[model samples]
Target: MKKLSFLFIIFILIHSSVSAIDRRTEQFSTEFGYLTLPLPYVIPGAGMGLGFLGGFNNVPFGST
Candidate 1:
């Protein structure tokens, strides 16, 4: 389950392309602050609850 999700994220990053319309592409930069909050585990192995909660409050210093 975790492996599948990791692969999916990797695939997205690999295939992701940037296209700016009005030169305001900074708003679309990939951020890692709270991006991990909303993962649904289809196959629960162990400690899944704690994992999701841990992602909520981990705001980085330069999070935009």
Candidate 2:
């Protein structure tokens, strides 16, 4: 019984700790002009990127 309880506690701790890390990619791209507004209460965290544009034609050279 003690061993089972210890294993359960360990499992819970591991799961919780693993989920604290953000597993999202660091970069993204959009083909069309758009805007992104994150939630007011949730500040954007590290390991993230953002971009804006008005239209595809206005994009600088060498960008596709």
> Best candidate, TM-score-wise?
2
lDDT of 2: 0.62
lDDT of 1 by residue, 1-64 (tens): 9999999998888776544347655744455555345455554565443335444344456735
Model 1 lDDT vs. the true structure? 0.59
Best prediction by lDDT: 2
Off by over 4 Å in 1: 17-64
Looking at model 2, which ten-residue stretch has the lowest summed lDDT?
51-60
lDDT of 2 by residue, 1-64 (tens): 9999999999999999888667586445434454555433434675455544332433445755
Clashing pairs in 1: none
Residue 8's lDDT in candidate 1: 95
